[model samples]
Target chain A: MNLLFAAEEAEEGGSGLVSPVIGVMLWTLIVFGITLIVLWKVAFPRIAEALDKRQRMIEESIDTAEKTKREADELLREYRERLSDARGQADDIVARARRTADAHEQESQAEARTKREEMMDQTRRDIEAETRRAIQQIRSEVADLTVLATEKVTRKSLDSSDQKRLVDEALAELDFAALANEERR
Target chain B: MSQSRKILLGAGGAYLLLVVLAFILFGSAGRQDFVPQEEFELPTWIELGPLDINKAVLYLLISGILTCVTMVYIAKRMEAKPNRIQTAVEVLYGVMRDNITRGNMNDKMAAKWFPFIGALFLFIWFNNLIGFIPLPTGHHHFTVLGLEIPTFGIYAATANVSVPLVLSLLVFFSYTFEGIRAKGVGGYLKSLIPAGVTGAMAGFIFVLELLSNIMRIVSLSVRLFANMLAGHLIILFMAGGLAILLGIAGIGVFLLPIGIALYLFEVGLVATLQAFIFATLSAIYIGGAVAESH
Candidate 1:
């Protein structure tokens, strides 16, 4: 039985192996054709589209980022300009205030000087008028004294020339005494 | 035109020449026995001992060398700009690049694996086409302890169950390694279990996953082995049928026309399809192995 099995195995092995090549070939052709068609038509197109969409999305994102950066730069430039303008305005205000203070100081100083001068002039005029009035009062008092003295010395009524001379000499002596007293005080 | 189309044409032409040569050589010699000659007597080159040397290994090595040299020569002579041969190679590269590697893996992963897949496809393709050529048909004769023993013709490396099994095992291990490396070992194991399952269901799923994981090796091996073996078998039967028909006394001459036509058609289709099947399965396996979790 074992010998028979061995003989059968030897005879059958190579022959059985050689007969199915044609059928396998036909089957392969059909399957491969079907696979290729399906892949080319449906699957491959979808995969390619997905890849293209991904590429577009990435490009768009990069573009948006670049645009944002540009906008930020523009805003920064505007802010810098505004800051510089503010600094310029602040300097101008300080300068204007300084000039106005100088003008006010000058005006105040001029008004004060003018008021001092007017007060001095009024004091000088009052002193001059008072001096003139004092001098007149002294003269009248001296005249009255002189007239009393003359009348006592002569015991009678005198002529106009004698009265005049006595009055003049007395007045002269009173003027000299007044001048010396004024000098001592 | 496309490189693939050009390669199809070239390969097709080469195949035609090979078929014509086989018919002229074998048909003129007259009908012989159904069993290949090597089965009865061994070729003198092989030897056996405590460590037996495989007769098929020498043939595979020769086939590999021929394939590599031919492909490299074609690649080198390719035009700087696109020509027929260059276009064919380019299309082959493109198919591997765009479809197999990139389709299966992320770009980073695909870059590393693309070369291996390319080499694999070319090797299998050349081997399958070479089978139709009129090489020495029979077993090898080698000395074993000063004794000679016969072995079968270089079992078209892809046709043997063992060879395809090993290829599949290599793929199986490599992908499993990739999964483990990509995700940690724990995570890799976890990935095998479907999400949203609970308790007993999860346990059941894990068992199923384990079984399937083991079955992956079997499936990969069987798919390749069956395809190549089946194609080879069909070609043999067709040829054998002609041989048997011609061996008959009188009516054999009339059947020659039908036999010749069928032989031409069968050989052509078988050669092309075997290569295609090998490449297609490799693509599918790699695709399945590396697909991202849903």
Candidate 2:
């Protein structure tokens, strides 16, 4: 019974606390070596590979995202530049059209003024001609009436030279040139 | 008060009453010697020509199997988006890779030695953690329905000096081999001495460095063995050993709480910490061996 219960029997000398046991050491070596081998062959390689893959995946994802953002920013900048150029072009076109319209208006006003001046000159010339003709006719008619009155008073006919002289005297006495200038004004 | 607070108060009062009752019943018994030696002694279960299979060997086997299986399982199921267990394993993997291996050595060396260091950490960690758990390994037995069953007891393979000594010896040889491989034997030895010393001082320093290099095995082994042995001894005594030796069983009631706290401290911090220290020291030694300067 005492032999079966080994823990109940105390050792005589030391407690054997620091004593080296060859079997235990050998077993430790064997067990640890086996574990290390199994893990090295089966488990560790897979895990290391997976971890490396995951790290690469994360890095690639980050790079792709950064690249996309950079492209988007570049596109936005280009669009803004194009829009600015278009706005400048539109402003230039509007200015050119306004300038052309202004030039056309000035040209039309000058042409209208020239046409009015020509019409006024032509009307003055016509009035001068008509007044002159009326004055000449009046002179002729006066000469005829003077000849009839002279005949009635003296009871005698006059010759061609006498008629001409009487008409020139009547025309001079009447101031027919001044009358024609007043009618033209 | 809150419901949790009320429950806590009730539990505390109950525990106090139980202690008082135990003190009244068993305070006057005659003293008895409950030696701790018996607990640490490894009784052989089987004899094979040159080997004696014992509790320590069993524990080592269990630790090896557990380390292998758990890592393999997690490895097989690993994904880009990890679940809880995979996340935890990844954290441990990072610690081993970045903090232990890569932190100590360059990429080429780290890659070469990561598997060994990782296995060493998991093995030691599992051994330490399982030591705190009570298992049916005690020499004493209980009878029920005419059947005998061994009682539960706490023990650690690392607590036995032989196990850690063997592991330290392995580490010592590994680092020495690496040093010799990286630099020839003469160069490696010469590198051990610090720079800018001459004459007798240089010789003396070289001898001292050689002795210190040899002492690494002892220091590494004893540090782990002593810490584990001390923690288990304290816990055992505080639980009942002291009370039984003093003939005052009731004293254990008071000591049990302290024992519980120590138990938690060992399980929660010391176990993991010892593993980390052992693995980190191994990495440092290996890395130092190949370095241009000591």
Candidate 3:
């Protein structure tokens, strides 16, 4: 009875394996069909959109950065050019100031030279005027002395007219003698 | 003719050819001797303990060769502008690339491992699909090199514990090597202990880390093997019930239709799921190996 039961159990076990296989296969097919449909329609599209959006955002950011960099470069170049222009203007101003200063220095030197020459000429004129005054006074004194000497040389009592004529003649003779002596010395 | 009709005709022709081949090869009375079963009282060639190397090796070789030829031919004939066959291949490639590889490992990493992962997926998928083709049903025998070899009509490579075990070991070693390469051995070992667990607890956590590391190999292999094996076993029982019911009763009432319906669904699901599970686990392992600590 046990042997017969074992044989029957073996047969049933063999047969039982078949139904589960079929059930699993059927379940697999249904699940696979649903998965494929859902994935194709919904999930795939959403994923693709998200990926595209990310790529676009990245590209836009890069482009914006590039544009900003270019603008900065342009501004920097302009600043440099302005700085150079300002330097050039400053150099021009310095050159003009130097030229003006040189001209002023030359004018001042010429004025000083003219003033010195005028002072020297004034001093020489004053010295010459002083010498002429002294020479004139000496000549007048010498004439009076000549008169007295003539009167003593005569050694006689005479009238006034005679004395005067004698004096004049004597003076004239002395003057002529003095002139000749000076010439000889 | 309509496009649908054209597709139907093509499919019908392929099915007829498959049926003819199955009948010619498997229908012979002489082939019964090659199927070695203690229950069936059949003879076989050399046996390795309980494992039949001749049968297993031949099946693997044949399956591998067939897959290689089909894939190579399809690859060569592929065009810039797709024909029907090319479109089919492209669709398969797209699914593997987008969903399996890219979905798990980001784009850059996917690019590195896509070829190997894709090949594995397609090979497993075709092997699983071939089991339902009605050719290699039940047991069969073939003689080669003066040896009688017993074999099944279809053998899911993933279903065999040894195959997944080998694949999982390969993945395990590969990730370990990657970790060591990316970060030195010292760093790799350091990485095993998560951050901020110090003092006496650190030692305990380290032990737990080691256990988890070992468990990765076990879980990867077992997950694939179990899923495939369970699927195959379920399919076997479904088909077998119809056969037994027909033998016992004059008419097989409700068994054939239900069995066939479930069989179809299970095959489709199992093929896709097995492929997905294998690819996902490989990606996870690789990702873990390369990931930086938080």
Candidate 4:
């Protein structure tokens, strides 16, 4: 069998290349074509598709992250704006209240000063009236004493003018408020 | 001893034992003077008058069917979330596509030609690899039970001229067709000579370019075939030297290390390199055809 193949090699080498026979070349072509077609149809496409899908998926993930980040930045900006607005409103309210409080304090202070001035004036008027009443009562009493003394001497009642004149005189002579001022000095 | 050292020693002993066993099986039985003159011969497996099915053809057929089956399986079981086998398959396909298609052509053209390029790469790669695997073919042409099983041994299909010839021819046809399509028939023919040459020099350049173009097919086939064939022959020659001295006891004990090393080199380097060369050359041809560049 070994020698048989050796003989075949020599015989087949007619055109200087036995290895590239017409029949086997055709056979190889046919077989190779079939296998290549199958590979083209099935294997390569699936692999490419998987690789393509992986690439797209990676891009999509990155895109989603970027979008989310943008949205977060937008939300943060909104919150910051709102926070500053609230701060402005709070500051405005505090300033308004402070002005209102200052106004209220000043108004109460003016009202208190007016009320004290009125009370002092009323007290002074009461003191003056009381002094006048005491002086009037003392004058009446002095006039009655003077009438009684004259009546004892002459056994006659005093006229009205006389009583009036006597009371006036006694009020002029007894100045208790002036005498109290002198005592204090 | 340290634990690591102990483990290393144990592993070394085990490896030594395996090597010894391999030498006994493959090294001892090499025939020294028994020149397998028939080993070079390639007769028709089934002769139907002129339509012969030789061992090379049979190996090609086997390679084709297996290539189809494997490719189909890879396509079918592909996952978006790849598992281990899927990852490995993806890596293989990635290498072919990246190096051959995108490396050779522009993106659009690469995409267009990916399937063809990948097919050639994978088919040739598998064919070259399968050649090394030993089958039950006859060793030095022996019979089992009074009946000779012709070609009853492993054969490297790619090592055969017809196989590489067919493959290279396919490439030649494709690239040539692409060239013609790109440049038109008139322009492509006109390109045979340099742009300004008129008479004898033009003719000379045309003849030279024409000869080189024809030689492309020859060189492509011969390169792959010779490499594969030479690698196998070297391995056999070394193993055959074992029977020169120590009978069945020692096979190229002197040559054992070198023989085994050469065999591994054949299996690893030559196989991969040839496949790459074939595919890359095809791409270059296609590139020359479709695109105009320096």
Q: Which candidate has the highest TM-score of all?
A: 2
lDDT of 1: 0.58
User: Across residues B1-294, which tens digit of lDDT does each residue of candidate 2 receive?
Assistant: 999999999999998888888889987886774566677877788997557888888888888888889889889988988888888898999999899999998899998999889888888898898899898887678988998988778888888888889889989998899999999999999989988888899999999999999999999999898899889989998988778767787888989999999999999999999989999999999999999988
The candidates, ranked best first by TM-score, are 2, 4, 1, 3
**B-chain TM-score of model 1:** 0.69
Residue A128, model 4: Cα distance from true site in angstroms:
5.6
Query: What tens-digit string does per-residue lDDT give for candidate 1 at B1-294?
Result: 999999999987876666566566555565554443223221224444322224234434555566556555554454434567656656665676677667766787676665555555555566556654545445445667986754323245456554455455656776788777877788777777877877988888988998988887777667666766555544444444345535542233334445466546635765455555555565555555555561
> Against the true two-chain complex, what DockQ does each candidate achieve?
0.01, 0.35, 0.01, 0.41
Tens digits of per-residue lDDT, candidate 3, B44-70, equal: 235544433333333344455565556
- Pitting candidate 1 against candidate 4, the one with the higher lDDT is 4
Worst 10 residues of 4 chain B by lDDT: B241-250
TM-score of chain A by itself in each prediction: 0.61, 0.69, 0.58, 0.63
Candidate 1 ranges with C-alpha deviation above 4 Å: A1-8, A11-185, B1-45, B48-55, B139-155, B241-272, B283-290
Where's the lowest-lDDT run of ten residues in candidate 3 chain A? Answer: A15-24
Residue A30 lDDT, candidate 2, scale 0-100: 91
The C-alpha lDDT values of all candidates are 0.58, 0.86, 0.58, 0.75
- The CA root-mean-square deviation of candidate 1, after full C-alpha superposition on the true structure, stands at 19.1
RMSD of each: 19.1, 4.5, 20.6, 5.9
Model 2: CAPRI class:
acceptable
Question: Which should have the higher DockQ, number 1 or number 2?
Answer: 2
